[model samples]
Structures are given as structure tokens and as C-alpha cells.
Target: MDLIIIAQAVGLFTVTNIDDIVVLALFFAQGAGERGTTAKIVAGQYLGFTAILAATLAATFGAGFLPEAVRAYFGLLPLLLGLRAAWKMWRGDDDDDAPGSNNGPALLTVATVTFANGGDNIGIYVPVFITVDHTGLAVYTAVFLLLVGVLCAVGRFLATRAPIARALSRWGHVLLPAVLIVLGIVILIEGGAFAL
Candidate 1:
């Protein structure tokens, strides 16, 4: 593996996954006290990212698996999640005390959200994948997976900070919904799902 290729892989992964830091941080805050939460999150992150890589790699191989238009629909996942959160707020259904109640299976929920949020990642990754040879592809995947672990660690560190965790706990319910809604809109627009 050339150093340039390694650098490119690192850069690409970092750029694509920058937003995931905050998402992971929020999850850490939410799962603060629960046993095995960190393990679940790390596993879910890997699961989700691996799926994204697989989809992108498959596309490179002429799998025709997920056209951009079809992938755009994945944005609906976060959009609906935001709407659901807003609905809960409207109905005065508090999730503060019951973190797990509305989230469904935590691991799957994280994985689903991660995958759904990866539409842009797929768009970026496929072009890069197309340019890379088999060895280069392996290098990229390794770098990406390594970065995922780093991201999880950083997210946990940030969430464990007193000020950061306190603020997130205080405002995350409102913030997460808005962020997800906006992210969904961005993904849809980027994918050309609809015009403004």
C-alpha cells in the first residue's frame, strides 16, 4: 500500500464520517449509565459502516444494487425519526426517563440509523472504489474500519466529559430531531430525490 493511498483512505473516511462523531456522542450520552452500552454502540457502528462499505463495493462491481435514486430513499429513515420525535414532543411523551422505550433494539437502531445516514458516504465511496484496485480497496476498508473505532472512542470521550454530557443530556431530545431532519433533507437534495 502506497502512503498516498493510505493518506487518501484516511482523508476520505474522515471527511465522510465527521458528522458521525456527534451522532455517536449523542448515543453515548443517552446510554450513559446502561451496562454494555458501549459494546453495543461499537458493534452497531461497525455493523453499519461495514454495510455501507459492502454496498459501495458491490456497486463498483456492477451489482447495480442501489442506484442513487433508490439510495436517496434511505433519507426517509432519519426524516421519519425526527418526525416521530417531534410527534412525541407534541403529545408530551417524555423519553427522558425511559431511554430505551421508543428506540427499539438499541444495536439495530444504531445500525439502521448509521446505514440510513450513509447515503452520502456511498456516493463518495463508490467513485473512489471504482478507481482503486483490489489491494487499494483492502487498504481503504482497513483504514475505514480503524477510523470507526477511533471515532467511537472519541465520541465516548466527548460524551463522558462533564460539560458536554450535561449539555447533551439537557438538549439532546430537541437537538437530535432537528439534526436528523436537516440531515435527511440534505441527503435527499444531494441525491436529487427532489428539487427545492
Candidate 2:
């Protein structure tokens, strides 16, 4: 495996998912005293992230057969998602869809939230994955999944610590929407959506 590919995978995954730490921490905190909650969270994270990567890989392959003009439209999904997130933020609406401490299956609830929150991830990843070869994509996927485990550990740790959790919560909620909006713009420009 190339070191450059590894480095790129690490950097890209970290930048795209730094906000997840706060989310996972909060989830962990909510399920702190419950048995099997940690396992459900970890499994759910993997399940959701795997689905995102699967979609990204499919889009990367599909993009090869599509015309540039059509491909440019791919940016719309993230742009709309970002706009929706910003609107919610402005309205001071909590993520009402978030998984709660209900008797329902925690894994499914967490997976749903993870997948919903990953719309921007698909937008960003498809472009990058399109640029990489098969080996590079495999490496990126492997690295990403590994980092998910690390993220879970970190989130669990943060749940046990109040200060860091609070600090991250203060910023993560505000930062992700902005990042999504910027990423949507960047993806659009890169794909020449505006030019089209």
C-alpha cells in the first residue's frame, strides 16, 4: 500500500467526519448505563458508513458512463442537504429524528441517523473516489472503517468525560452545517455545475 494513499485516506476521513465524534459521544452518553448500547452504536456506525461507501463506489463507477453535464447534477443532493441543515439550525430545531433511549432497536435508529447525516459525505466522497483507482478506493475504504472504530472509542471516552464532551458539543453542532454548505459549493465548482 502506498503511504500517500494512506495519508490521503486518513486526512480526508478525519476532515469529513470530525463532527461525528461529538454525535457519537452524545449517543454514548444517552445510552451510558444501558447494557449492549456500546455494541449497538459501534455496529450501527459500521453499518451506516459501509452503506455510504457502497453508494460512493457505485456512483464512482456510474459516473464513468455518464456525461459531464449530467455528472454535474450530482452536487445537488449535498447542496440541498446543506441548505436543509442550515435552515434547521436557523430555526433552532433540535434533530428530532435523533435516536433516543427508547425500547426500539438502537442499532436501527443510530444507523438511520448516520445514513441521513451522511448525505454530504456521499457528495464529497463520490468525487474523490472517482479520481482514485481500484486499489486506492480499497485503501480509502479500509482506512475509513478502521477510523470508525477509533471514533467509537473516542466517543465513548468523551462520554465518560464532561469537559471535552461539552466543548465538542458546543462547536460540532454549529460547524457541520457550515462545512456541508462549503463542501457542496466546492463540489459544484469542481464538477463545473455553475459553468453548465
How much is 45 displaced in model 2, in angstroms?
A: 0.7
Residue range 1-196, candidate 1, lDDT tens digits:
5799999999998888989898888878867877778898899889998999999999988899798778888888778777776677667786632223234227766786789888778888998899989999999989899999999999999999999989987877667677778877877777778952
Name model 2 segments beyond 4 Å from true: 63-98, 102-105, 162-196
Measured on C-alpha atoms, candidate 2 has an lDDT of: 0.69
Model 1: lDDT of residue 155? 91
Winner by TM-score: 1
Weakest 10 consecutive residues, lDDT, candidate 2?
96-105
Candidate 1: residue 160 Cα off by (Å): 1.2
In order, what lDDT does every prediction score?
0.80, 0.69
User: Could you tally the backbone clashes for each prediction?
Assistant: 0, 0
